[model samples]
Target: MSFNITDEEVKKLEDVASQVRRDILRMVHGCGSGHPGGALGCTDLLVALYFKEMTHNPEFSMDGKDEDLFFLSNGHISAVLYSTLARAGYFPVPELATHRKINSRLQGHPATEEGLPGIRMASGSLGQGLSVAAGAAQTKKLNGDDKFVYVLMGDGEQQEGQIWEAAMYAPHNKVDNLIGFVDYNNAQIDGSTDEVLNLLDLGAKYKAFGWHVITCEKGNDMKTVLETIQEAKAASKQGTPVMVLLKTEMGHPIDFMVGTHKWHGQAPNDEQLASALGQVKETLGDY
Candidate 1:
């Protein structure tokens, strides 16, 4: 499908991104433990997809028809996806308050077991969601559905061999309907990506893997993100898969949290949470 985001739509996405940031901090604080760095880093991209890009009916079930599918490969950041999906009306935003709680549909990682409306597959395990997205893309082609499948992965998660395997399969099988995004924030659970396991030259790596690569220096910028996604869609040919390596600062807009790996899997205390929420206006009201 062709992308047509208006200026008004971009503004709405920006607002949504702010609300998503609020939800991420609140959810992690509620859980008392979870990933927040990657969650904050990917907030803009997720907001752009759910609010301004993807053709999805939050009310509709995940049946793989008439909807553009999105898979979050690095599932530890479920807070971002959960908040975006909720704000987009996939589910009530109140559910975010229950994130990572026992028996809550909002799990620490996305899971089909809860029958979550927006989540099609369980994704905590790194390196698997791309294959799922590729399979969905192939299915759409076979069934004559022209919709696209989008998947998001962390830059560090590339260390998983399964990702490269899916990378090889998507182009060989001509899964042009699939587009993958990497949250190239350079921070993971333990430390910076380069310090842990260097994924340098990610663009060249994707190019060598036979996929079209696009780079976005500021993944958190709404207008730039919208334009980059449009460019990626325009660049999609019938034979090559597309990947966007989005450079973003983890825990962005929160001065204390930005550029640190500490927020990768740690919750903010009450004072810190208040500070974070103070920066983000509660547009559409908090749950």
Candidate 2:
């Protein structure tokens, strides 16, 4: 279950990603608390990273050793991370039902206090993960480990001063082993990023900070996500940090949920749940 998805494994990943989306819907609906829009939109990217790209061991260690490390800066989207970790064999998939429940290991945002196998640090506050990832990447380099460090952040989070601070620091410190991605879906909690606070020219901004920038115009598409990740990895060693602008819709998969900020943190009602799940086929058994 922890194998990288080669050409023959692509369909298997698609099946598992559908199931992950289903888990996202059910987890948020069951708890009546979660941010599903971003989770749904970023599913393909998570699937590609966990199932096909990164070299990770779900046997779960604090120190990643030679494995590629991933940090989720936009922790509001824990549903996708938890489900993807489960399907990737980090833990039993059935444990997904415990999400957001009292004393559940799967906190609303990922936490290390719960001893979750896949989580490395406690994250919920924005703009901190990139700094942590930069430190981790530097540690890896010190240890002579050539593996890359990956981090995901939301489009709106770019407004945080700390993000730019880290953005400016990574290249200055030559954090070349770090590959950071922004979910440039253009939607946030209050409203669309443009309506709330516009993040214009994300690629140019990263490049201006002395980092190598790549673009994925179709982040929702599996092929495009996979190919772009490889492209990022290929460019990771060019004496500068790498940034990927992963463009996606706020709400995806579900017809009603798609292209709207209304569903960003709202739970679906019974009618909406059925309508949403109808679009994503249950490929793996539901939790």
Candidate 3:
């Protein structure tokens, strides 16, 4: 089932996001690693996609046949994707405990060697997933599959020359089936993106690259997040690929981590985990 979202159903998606956030915190806290800031910030966006937007089977497949595919370019946020995949029924939620451990399919970032059900690429080195997604879009086109290819990247990843090349390639090649998302939280591992390296006017930049661009002003809001994806998909139908600039708080819902760059790769301690968990409701129980 893809989606037929309504106002009343927004709460359902919010519950999914909340539990996913808790999973993210616990997964990172359990392993004492993983990037929670971007994971938490991008929770609503992923939840909106997996739970309410993308049409795909829970059964794993290396070649996603006739289905919508997702690629996580900023692989450091593996916590969110693992949580989303588990919650979406790709695997048992308890499997989240295996993350970051030796021999675990759920690596610190999404890993293909482990044959992770939902991950098509091992994408830790930033600024590469967009091109991968673009290639997948082209494959689907050649295979006569109209399904969409979705990819998410960090705002800081925009600095990479490879990303710009793919950004230019997608629209120029008329790969309209691909939808790209940028987690515009402004926080990167080292510091705020502006402090590190300014990425100005992403909407204008993507538009200039010939992409149909959309802005999600409040990506943390489930309704707005889901609605924005719908808008992006609609925009992608007219022979131009779409790129969405999703504005988010680096560490959303967690009071101490919110709006800061410090939590990018830092896991919360025992007391901190307790407090963070309090802010995010635990639904569907924790893995």
Candidate 3: tens digits of C-alpha lDDT, residues 110-185: 8888787888889998899999999999999999999999999999999999999998899989999999999999
Candidate 2 Cα misplacement greater than 4 A, ranges: 1-7
Give candidate 3's TM-score: 0.97
Q: What are the candidates' C-alpha RMSDs?
A: 1.7, 2.7, 1.9
How much lDDT does each candidate structure score?
0.89, 0.91, 0.91
The pairs that clash in candidate 1 are none
Question: Which 10 residues in a row give candidate 1 its minimum summed lDDT?
Answer: 1-10
Off by over 4 Å in 3: 1-4
lDDT per residue (tens digit) for residues 1-287 in model 2 = 12223665677777878999999999999998899999999999999999889999999899999999999999999999999999989889999999999989999999999899899988889989999999999999999999999999999899999999999999998999999999998888898889898887878889899999999999988877888888888888778999999999877878998878888888898899999999999988898
Shift in Å, residue 132, candidate 3: 0.6
Please, what are the lDDT tens digits per residue for candidate 1 over residues 173-214? Answer: 889989999999999878899999998898998898899999
TM-score, every prediction: 0.97, 0.97, 0.97
Which candidate, 1 or 2, has the higher lDDT? 2
Deviation of model 2 at 92, angstroms:
1.5
